[model samples]
Target: MRSAIWVGAILATLAIASMFLLDPSLWFAPERNTLIVQTFVAAVVAAQLTLVTAMPLAMIISSLRNRTKTPLPTYIVTVCECGAVFKSKPMFCSRCGRRLQEPQTKQAV
Candidate 1:
């Protein structure tokens, strides 16, 4: 949450800076309100849309992996289930469905 706030703040500040640079005369003009307002509005809307889109994707990935029982999360849980009988630590584990052990896992080569 703190990182999200920091990210939003940084992006908003950059957008504001860019907007000001794009319209230097706006800083002194009475009608400059429109540019400032639009910059903030667009920044907030874009940040919110990004968070909304990302949150559901993370939840869905977790839910789908839990349902699959692919030992993907198992490795996360620190239980290497490369086989049915025993659980061992993976030798060269990269969690994107590649098993780099002696006997290859049937899940993905």
Candidate 2:
């Protein structure tokens, strides 16, 4: 949300500059001192836009990782699962090819 706001603010500033066709002399009033200020502000605005675009992309990738899962039911299986399909009826790790402790067996015994 904050990144989005930063992007909006930067775009608004650019629009303002283009709308007014802001004269460079105004910034340099008397001694053309606005050169340094203009360069610094431009750099800051570009960096902000870059971050604003990058953060949302990162958020999307993290949200799309549907295969990710955490193995907490057993101590023998790997802890963090990145890409694997889990089934309850068969009780097996498809990626590692290991059988999980059958719940039915535990109940029966």
- Give the candidate number with the greatest lDDT: 1
Candidate 1 per-residue C-alpha lDDT over 5-109 given as tens digits, one digit per residue, 9 for 90 to 100: 566777878987887788787689987777667766777677777888889999999998889774453222232344322244455444444454653333321
Give the C-alpha miss distance for residue 43 in model 1, angstroms.
1.1
My TM-score estimates for the predictions, one after another, are 0.47, 0.34
List model 2 lDDT by residue over 4-106, tens digit each: 5566567656754663466755554664445445654665677677787898898998887844855345323232133453334446666676665643322
Candidate 2, residue 64: the lDDT equals 75
Which residue runs does candidate 1 get wrong by more than 4 Å? Answer: 1-6, 64-109
lDDT of candidate 2 at residue 80, scale 0 to 100 = 17
lDDT of 1: 0.63
Model 1 residue 92 CA deviation (Å) reads 28
Quote the positional error of residue 5 for candidate 2 in Å. Answer: 14
